[model samples]
Target: MITQVQVKGLMFDPYNNAYIVILRDDEQSEMLPIWVGKSEASSISLALENVAPPRPMTHDFMKSYLDAFDAKVISVVITDLNENTYFAKIHLTYVDSEYTVDARPSDAIALALRSHAPIFASESVIRKQSSEELDQWLENLKPEDFGKLDS
Candidate 1:
């Protein structure tokens, strides 16, 4: 089973020296935190802020390629978590056919945001992320800890 989710916010993990993109369900109840590199976080943050760079970024280029081919991003699904890594798929429709492309969760999410595609996460992935360490980290987050896009 998969549950639809949205990009809730972006935060910094000082300990890991990485940025985290938080995906939240409609009720804002369930959340999945995926740690990503600074560059990836910047790409996603720009999309979330609706800011278009003077030059197209990698994700923008991908979207443009799909647009040129008249393809549409149907959705992006966070499908699995293994070895402390998360996996995702980008579902697309083109020329009356559909295709699923394997992608990193961060990249898939950035494209989804740019393409106006919905995001989802498999139940098993969610369950796998429900670790006590994650719980503690989440509980420790303050309101100001999020939206650290520029930093």
Candidate 2:
């Protein structure tokens, strides 16, 4: 089972010295947080704010390639969680044929946002990521912790 979700926010994790991209369903009942690198976070942030960089970033360049090929991202699906790592797939349609490509969640999300495609997550992944530890961490987050990606 898969549930439709959206990029809720980007947050910094001081303990891990990493950024977390939060995805949540419409009702906010299920949340998935994926730890990502600074570059990936920046890309996702730019998409979230609809900020176009002076030059096309990696995700933007990828989107342009898709445009050149007349391909459309149908959706992005967070498919699995293994040993604390999450997996995702980019569903695309080109020349009347659909294809699914494996991708990191962060990259898939950035492209999805850029292409106006929907995001989703497997029900099992949602359950796996929603734990007591994560609940405590989220509850402890301060408003200042959530912000745009630092340049």
User: Candidate 1: worst 10 consecutive residues by lDDT?
Assistant: 142-151
Q: Model 2 clash pairs?
A: none
Where model 1 places Cα greater than 4 Å from the true spot, the runs are 131-133, 137-151
Candidate 2 regions off by >4 Å?
A: 131-133, 137-151
Estimated TM-score for each candidate: 0.87, 0.88
- Candidate 2 C-alpha lDDT tens digits along 1-151: 9999989899887855678898988898878888888899999999999999999999999999999989999999999987767889999999989999999998999999999999999999988877465789678966555443222
Deviation (Å) of 94 in candidate 1: 0.9
